[model samples]
Target: MSGRFAPYGWSLVLHAVVVALLGVSLHAPAPRPQPAAAQAEAEPIQARAVDEAQVQAEVQRLRDEARRQQQQEEARRQQLRDEAQRAREVRQREEQRAAEVKRRAEEEQRQRAAAEQERKAKEAAEQKRLADLQKAAEEAEKKRIAEEKKARELEARRKQEEEARKKAAAEADLKAKMAEAQRQMEAEAQKRAQERARQNATLVQQYIADIRNKVERNWLRPATARPGMTCTVLVQQLPTGDVVNVRITRGSGDAVFDRSVEIAVHKATPLPPPPVPELWEREIEFIFEAR
Candidate 1:
């Protein structure tokens, strides 16, 4: 088994095999004595001792080599198994790392999708809220406009009614004033007419007195006249107070007295003119008495 003794051990096994071969050849049967003078010379006989211990040592060396080769083969197989196990562990680690990467990627994708959905939902809600607000504003505006229009119409109607009432009051006031004016004018006219009539009557009396005084001044007393005699005489006159006719409407019993009254009336001619034009008449009558 020691490297230093291996060559000596191989040399000893070779020598043993040569000694066995020589022994067989030397111990073979002698041939018949060759005829004298034709026989070859015989070599010297060499004797070698076979050592059992050296043979045993050689066999042990062969066994040791075989054992060493078997140990080498088993070592190689163990190394191959270790290398395969290491490869399998490396492949498993790589696969685990790849699976982790894929899981992370998938999770990121899911999160992004969720975020996008949330954003879209919020945007839609905002749009709907804006639309609702706009619709409410429009309705409120319409209501305000309608109320304003109604208020304006009511105000216009009220103003028109007020104007109509004022107009009616004015017309009533005007009618009352006109009726009062008419009454005052009629009363004034009646008062003026009565004053004129009174003045005309006074003037008529004065004229009648003048006529009687003139007739008496012109009378000549009849000697046959009796005291307390009276006569009614009718006289007719013109606008110039000139007598046109005279007659006795009632005579005294004394014909001479009545005749004298008629004569006096005629002598009175051109009787006094009336003070007013309207008082002049075509006929006049007076009473005469003897004083």
Candidate 2:
């Protein structure tokens, strides 16, 4: 009744008042005889007067209720507007806070990005430094290896030179010893040759005599041969005392005697060896005489 229901109450009251007037009008008697009609009209006028006063009271109550309801509606509308304003202020504050948070987050992200970039740069520099160090170490290792190789080569060459010097010295000493031995051998050989010549002086004559006797035994006298026939024969022999060749250096006057003498020498195929190897000769000469 204080708000939306006030108008409804006013309408109900007005309707009730109309219904009472209608009933009164409907129940009133028809126009009566003059004296009775006047009395009935007077009673209806008094009843209408009472109904009009009630109607005025109801109208006043309706007016007062409408005013109260209007005031309450105005207050409700004012409260709604205040709540809406508060909501707007709160929304604005939230927007401001959100903007500030976003700005801070963007700043932090930028700082983190800068730090990450710096870290990557430092890592790259460190890697390059390590690579340089490794390269230097490799170069040092190569230098050390080269130095060791050079030292080894020098040592090997020194050993080879030492060995060569020793070999040359040994060869020189051997040559000197061989020269001394050769001189001694030559001296001994000359001494032995003189001794052999002295010893073979008589043996050589006997060897010739033995060869003449052998030829005489093998000879066949020719019919034309004569006493006093004398010839010097040259004979060639081998180391085994085998006759290799024969010739008459001096011949007898008769051809038959000369041929017979040459045949006799040939018939003595193998003669005799010398008593000493030094006395052996490849050639021998002898005189043949027919007595």
Candidate 3:
């Protein structure tokens, strides 16, 4: 029992000492030994026993109060630890959220940069295509102009050649007409000359016949004249066809017959006139005969 209470032995001893001092102060004076002295002494001893029991009970109550206070301090320390752990967890979650936001912002910036570059490239390609089309159109226009110029030149040359050919043909036709006209004029002159000659011949024959008939009608047949007697006579006449002279070119051997033929030609005066003036002869000879 002493070993079990050894941990609180000093506290129990101090309590017992305090209780003994209080009992001494509260005790009455001892009575003188007499017939009632034993009873008084016995009461003092019981009172001392009661006081010791009360001291023991008070020490036990003090020890129970100290134990309760220590348990309440331990509970407060556990609650503080739990609060600190919860605060640390909240700080870590906030830092993670900040990092995620920064990463998303950086990705969006990269996408914007790529889109800008693609837009510039597309614009440059469109400009180049428009320039190529303009160049092609200019070349086509130049070619068309050159072809038109060449065609116009060809047409002009063809027209010139056609005009030259027509001029030459006209000249050839005029020359042919002039040559034919010249030939026709020469043939007409020859035909007129032949007609005049024939007309002159006929007029001369008619005049000779008229002279013979007139001389025969006027001739008086001389007795010395015979049928074989013939002579040539020449006569001259005025524009009025009157005979002016008569000569015998060849006379017959009989002089009387020649004179008779001469006298007959003179008596036949005023010979027949020619039909055309071109047929009139200033001198003429005729044969005279008595037949």
Candidate 4:
């Protein structure tokens, strides 16, 4: 309903009801006639028809007013009903709009929450990937370090083995050299003693004469000396003018004669001098009969 009509509409209805009530009060029913007043009023027979007509007209007028008032009341009530219906439709429309806004708001909230969840998931995945990469790198580094350590150990072992081999070789060489040197020394000493024993008897005939002189007078041998017979000797001398040797100065066999000659030499230890000191010799040669 229009603002201009809604408030005034009820007020007009109230004013009409008040006016109807006043009309009813003013038009009260006629009272009963008194006998003397009735006789006096009966004397006006000439105006009776006009009075009847006027009364009929008055009754018709009152009936028409009641019909008009009823129509006005019905119209006022219908207007009020239409205004109430319009107000109800307006309220319904507002409520529907409010519901639509609420639904949209709810949808927006859901979308935002879903987006946030997705974002969080993405971030978590990234972090996990980075962590995995770091772990892999660490493992690789560890493997590399382990391999290096193993290689170093192997190198150390190899070095130790090589050192041991070198030391062993050096020791073996030293031992061999020492043994050879000792043998050489022994040979040299023997050679030295032999050289000291005699002036080298280069002439075979002289060597045989020297052997004869060292033999006993009773010892006998063939006149012709052997050829290609050679030997060597080692000796220890006593401080007395006598010599004691493990055996005689070199000999080819004829052992009996060799023993006899050695005995004679021992018995005549303070040997007669050679022709001169220049001819003196610690070694002598002996040649014997041919076999």
Q: What is the Cα-based lDDT of residue 185 in candidate 2? A: 79
Candidate 3 per-residue lDDT, tens place, 1-291, comes to: 454334355554655776676577559675465557577676777786686567556655544543444444446446656766677677667677777777777777777777777777777777778878888888888888888888888888778777777777777777767766776776676676667767666767778778878888988888888897888888888877788888888878888888887787788888888878777776778887678
lDDT at 65, model 4: 56
Candidate 1 residue-wise lDDT, 1-291, digit = tens: 266345555555665675665576568776556555434422222212233345446546655654565555557557767877888888888888888888888888888888888888888888888888888889888988888888888888877877777777777777777777777777777777777767766776776767877898989989998778888888898888888998899988888998888888888887877777788888888788888
Show pairs that collide, candidate 2: none
Better of 3 and 4 by lDDT: 3
Clashes within 3 Å, all models in order = 1, 0, 0, 2
Candidate number achieving the greatest TM-score relative to the actual structure = 4
Cα lDDT of model 2 overall?
Answer: 0.79
Which window of 10 residues has the lowest lDDT sum in candidate 1? 41-50
Task: Encode model 2's per-residue lDDT on 1-291: one tens digit a residue.
Answer: 265455555655765665676677668876555587577677777787686677666656655665665566667667767878888889888888888888888888888898898899989999989999999999999999999999999999998998898888888888778877777777777777676766686678778778887888899998877788988889999888789988889887677887787888788768776767787888998889887
lDDT of 1 at 290: 81
Model 4 spans > 4 angstroms off: 1-39, 42-93, 162-208, 213-285, 288-291
Better by lDDT, candidate 2 or 1: 2
Indicate whether candidate 3 or candidate 4 has the larger TM-score.
Answer: 4
Name the 10 consecutive residues with the lowest summed lDDT in model 3: 65-74
Model 1 gets an lDDT of 0.75
